[model samples]
Target: MDTCKNCGKPLENPDQELCPACRAVENAKARTRREEKAGHARRRRMNRTTRKMLIAVCVLAVVFTGLCVTATVMYDKYNPDEFIASVDAALEAGDARALKNLLKGEDLTVSDEGAAALCRAFTDAAQREALRGQLEDQVVDGGAQGAFPALGVEKESVFFGYSRYSLTVHSVRLLLSSPVQNLRLSLDGVPRTGEQTADGILYQNLFPGLYTCTVTGTTAAGQAVEGDATDLALLSSVEPTVFSGALPIADITVSGCVNDGAVITVDGAAVEQKPVNGVVTLPQVAVGSTIGMQYTAPWGAVTTASVQFADKTVTTLAFENPVTEGGVPAAGELNTLLTAHYAAYLDALNNQDTALISGCTEEYKAALAQGVVSDTHKANLYVMGTAECNPAAIKSTAADGTARVSCYVKLTYTHSDRESHEETPATAYRVYTFTWADGWKVSASADSTEEAYNTASMDALP
Candidate 1:
C-alpha cells in the first residue's frame, strides 16, 4: 500500500493519505456549489428585465388603440354650421327657455350674426330685450330704436380660407359669425370671422366616404337646439325642398239664405258679400300654420272663424243653417211641392171648368175681381166673354221678409168676336204669397196696361 509522502497515515488497500481526507473532499465540493449559485443569480436577473420590457410594449399598444377609438368618435360629432343655427329655430318659436339656455356660461361678444338672429326672433324692442336677458352674452340697448342692433359683417366671410375645400379633408373650419358677435367658432383650431347670410354655409375637405353633418346656431334670445343628417356620403348630391306664402286655414262652416247675402274674408281681407249657396273658397295654402277668417251675413251681422291649414292644400266652406221666408222647407223641397201644385193649376186653367180651378185661393178670386171692367162689375151676364190668363216668370225681392215672390203674367178677354177670329195680348205682373192655412195665394198684380188697370183699382171701381 502507498501513502502520501507528506503525511504519515495508515493505508487502506495499498494507496492511502490520512483519515481526514474525506473532510477535505467535502470542503472542495462546498466551494464549487458557491460558484454555481453566483452564476444562477445572474441569469435570473437578466430574465426579469426581458419580461418587464415585453409587458411595457403590450400596455403601450393597448393605450394607442384606445386613443384611436376616442378620436374617431369625437370626429364623427364635428360639424361647422351648428355653431349658429340653434338660434334660428328658437326665435321662430318664441321660446323663452331655449333663448335662456343658449346664453348659459358662454364667453362671447355680440356679433353680426347674433344681431340678425335677435332681430329675426323678436320684431319689437321690448320683446328683443327680454330675449337678450335670456340668451344674450350682452344686452346692447339702443334707446333710439333706429336699428341700433344692426349686424356688421366683414367682407372676408364670403369665401372659404382654403383655395377651395377639397372633398377629402374631414377636418372642420368653424367660421366665426362676421363681426365676431356672440358666437364662438374655430377653423382647424384657429379663430376666424362670424356672420350669418342667406347663401348658407359650405363645409369641404371631408374624407371620400359617408358622413353626417350637423348645423347648430342660437340667437341670444333662443335656446340651444340641434339638427343632424346621417349616412350622407361625402361625394353624394344633396337637395332640399322649400315653400312660400302664408299658411292655409281649415274649411269654414256657413249656413244662411243665398240671395239674402253673406260675406267671406280670407287672411283678414274682405273679399265678397252675399255669396251664393253659402260658399266661400280660400286660396290654396302651405302646410303647417294657423289661418284666421271672418264672415258677415246679410244685414251686416258678422262672425269669426279659423283653421289649421295643411301644406299645399285648399279650404272649402259649407253653410251651417239656412233660413227662408214663408216657413217653407228648403228651396229644394219647396220646388217639389210648388211644382206639383203649379202643374195642376195650369191643367185646370186649360180645361176652363169652374171645378178645375176650384183649388184657387180666395185671394186669387179677389185679385180677379179688381181686373173686371168698372161698368160691368156687378152684371151677372157674360159681358166680356171668355177670360184668359197666362202665367209669367217669378222673381224674389231683396231677401228681406218684406219682399217675397212675385210673378209676371198677362190676361185678355173677348167682349165679342167682331170679325171672325180675334185675339188680344195683355201683360201684367202679379205678386204671390203664402199663409199657413191658405197654402198658396195671390197678393197683388200690376199690369203693363197700368193706366187702365189703375182706373179699375178697388177703391176706384163701382
Candidate 2:
C-alpha cells in the first residue's frame, strides 16, 4: 500500500494516496491556495483601475488651472477699462465695499469703517466729478498697454463727497483753550459732562442747533470764574469752536538794587521771571497774588523783596536799600578808609592782636575772641601773614548815617599744629558796619555773621 506522504496511516485502497482525513486536509489546502491566488489577481486589477483614475484627475486639474490663469489674464488685460469704469461708478455712489473690491494690492486690508471714513472725507461734489474724469482719461490713454493705473486704495487716501446720510448725522464740538480743573460745563441749559484732553476739553456729539454753552471753575485762591457763549447757532461741524476769555489779573513791576535774574514768587507759587537790563517785570499776576523777589549779589550779598498784589496797572515796588554814613570824607574816600581798616582788622585777627578790634562792636569782638583765639588755642593751631580784603561795593548812607559795605577777603596763612605745619587758604564774604567816631573806625558789629571758608585739614577744635 502506498503510504500517503502524509500521516503514517496505511492507505485504504491502492489508488488512494493518503488516509481520508489526510486527503481531505490536502484538498482543503489546495483550494485555499487557489482562492488566495484569485484574490491577488483581483487586487492587481483594482490597483490598475485606481491608478488610471488618479492620472485622469491630475490631468483635468492641470488643464482647469491653466484655463483659469488664462481667463484671469485675459480679463485683466482686455476688460481693465470696464473694471475701472465700475470702480468709478462705485466711488461716485459712495459704495465702500464695491470700491474695496475694485482696488487690489497685497498690502491692502481696508475695513468697512475705514472705507466709509475715506469716502466721507471729500465733502465737495466737484472733487468727485474730477476724480471720475481722471479715471476715464487713464482708461482712454491706456488703450493697449493694459494699464489699470493703480487705484492705490491702500497707498493713497481717496476722499470722495460725503453721502447725504452722513451730513444728517454730523454734530458740533466745542474746544476750550485751557483745561480748567474740576470744571462744570452746560449746554442748552442741560449739564453735559465731558473729560479733559491734553490741549483742552472737547464736548462731542452735540446736535447742530441753537444753544448756550457755559463753563465755570473756582480759582486756586477761592475766586469763582464763569464764562459763557450766548445765542450760538453752531451750524457747521467743519470749523472748530474755540472758547477763550479773560481772567482777572494784576500787573506789577519790581525794581531795586537786586541783581538781574531774580526769582519772583506770586502767592507762594513761583512765577517764571525774566529780566531785561536788570529789571524784573511781572506781566500777568492774579489778583491778590503775593509777590516776592530774591537774588544773590557778588560776595554772597543776598537781597529779598515781597509785596501784596492788587488788581490795577503796573505797580512799582522798590526794595529796601542798605544804609551808609556820610561825613567830611566823601563816600568814595570813606570806602577807601573802610577798605584799609578791614584789611588791618583781618591782619590783627590772624596775629591774635586783641588791641586792633577794641573799637569793634561787642558782638563782633566776642565772636573774634571765641571763634579765632579760643577755638584755635584748644586745637593747638597758629595762623600767620596778613589776610587780603577786597571791597566789592558800598551802599549809600541811610537817614541814620549808617552804611553797609560788602567785601571779599582771601586769607592765606600757614596753619600749624604743635606737631606739623600746612599752608591753608581761606575765603569769606564780610559785611562791615562803620559809625563815624572822628575817623572811620571798625565797628564791633556786622550786618550778619561774616561767612568764613577755610580749606585747612585740621582736627575739629572746641
Candidate 3:
C-alpha cells in the first residue's frame, strides 16, 4: 500500500502521488491561485491609470500656483496699497536695499543719497518697532490706515471725535542775542519733536489739553539754553495755541536720600528719567513760578516739597523720608542729637550715675553689674578728674536712616587705697548705635565682640 503525500491517506495504487480526497483539495488550491493572479493584473492596470491622473492634476495645480504668484507680484507693483505694504515690510525688516527698490519716482531715484535717507528713516529701533506693530495690526485686521509717511504713503482715514489739535512753537532772539539751534521740545513731560530754526516748532494732531512745553537748545557759542513755558492751553482748532519764549532758565538742583529707584515729579508732572542716581538736577525750570515737587520712594513712601522762585536762581533741596513720619530726624539734626547725647552720657559717667549706665545697652548693663561697676568694687574706685566724651564722626546710615556714632572719651581715674595722689589718664574710643522710634536711642548689642568699646563697663569705674 501507498499513502497520499499531503494527508497520508492509503491509496489502492502505490504509484499515485496522492489519494483522491487529497487530489481534489490540490485542484481547488491551484484554481484559486490562478484567479488571484488575474485579479492582481487587473489592479495593476487600474493603479497605472490613477497615477497618470494624479500626476496631471499635480502639474496643473503647480501651474495654477505659479500663475497666482505672478498675478500677485504684478498687482503689487501697480497697486499703491500693495506698494506701500511692500515698502513697509522692507522698512520693518530694516532692509535698506529692499526699501530703496520700493522707493522710486521721478523726483526720487534709487541712488546713494536715496538709500542713505531710507536707512536713516528706518535706523531707529524704536521707530521700526512702531512701524512693525502698525503693520501687524493692519495684517491682522485687513485695514489700511496709519501708512508710512516717510515712504510717501498717506493715511487712509483719521478717526474723528478725538481731542487732536496742533500747535506751533518758536524761539525769539532779542536784539543783542544770537539765534538758538537744534531746539528740542518736550510736550506733557515727553520728548515730542525737535526743530532747528528759531522760527517756530509745529506739533500737529496732538490731543487738545494743557500741555507743559519745555524747550532746550544750545546757543551759537555752544552755551546751553533751556526754559519751560508750561501749561500752554490748546482749547480748539479755532483757538489754537501759539507759544514763544526766550531761554533764560534757572538751574535748580534737587538732592536727597531718596531710595535708589525713586521717581521725582515737578509741577505735578512726572519727569521722564533714565536710571536716576538719587539726585535729579533740572536745568530748564521756568522762573517766577512756585515749583511743586513730589518724590516717590522705593519703599512706597511719598513726600512733597515746594520751591519758591523768589528766593534765588540756584537752589538745593533735601527731601525727608515720610515713612518714619517725623520720628527720625534729618542727617544734620541726627548728628547734633548724637553729640548732645554723648555729652550727657559722659556727664553721667563722670558723676557715677548708675541709673544712666543701666539705661544703655543690655550687654553694657550686664558687664557693668558683673565687672568693675559691682557694688563691692565701687567703694575702692575713685574718679581723680572729669570725663570728657565728644562725638567724633557719624558713620554711614542704614536704610532706615540709623547710624553708628563714634566718640572719643578722655578720663582720669585712680584707686582710693593708692598712696600717691597720682591719677591714670585713659582715652577710649566708643561707638553708639543710634536708631529712631519715637525718639533717638542708643542701640545695644552683645559686648563679647570687640568691635566697639564697652562704654557701660567703663562708666562704672570710679
Please tell me which predicted candidate would have the highest lDDT against the true structure: 2
Clashes of each: 38, 9, 3
What's the CA error at residue 65 for candidate 3, in Å?
Answer: 59
Summarize candidate 3's per-residue lDDT along 60-83 as a digit string, tens digits: 999999988876765554544564
lDDT per model vs. reference: 0.36, 0.51, 0.48
Q: Score residue 395 of candidate 2 by CA lDDT.
A: 36
C-alpha RMSD between model 3 and the true structure:
29.3
For model 3, give the 10-residue run with minimal summed lDDT. 165-174
lDDT of 1 by residue, 1-462 (tens): 455444656556453444467547767889899989998999888888798888888999999998787666543433222322444445556553464444321123433343333334354446435433432222122222222222211111222221111001112222222211144333223333433445333333222222233333432222232322322222221221111101122233333334434444433444443445644444322234333444333323244444544433344434434333333223343344344434444334433333433233566544443334334322222222222222223333334323333332223232223344344433332323422223433444343454533333323211
Off by over 4 Å in 1: 1-7, 10-237, 243-257, 265-279, 284-317, 324-374, 377-402, 405-462
Question: By how many angstroms RMSD does model 2 differ from the true structure?
Answer: 28.2
Better of 2 and 3 by TM-score: 2
In terms of TM-score, the best-performing candidate is: 2
TM-score: model 1 vs. ground truth:
0.25
Task: State in Å the error of residue 76, model 3.
Answer: 37
lDDT of 2 by residue, 55-166 (tens): 9999999999998887776555445455556655665678768755554323234456435443543234664565556555544452222111222222222223211111
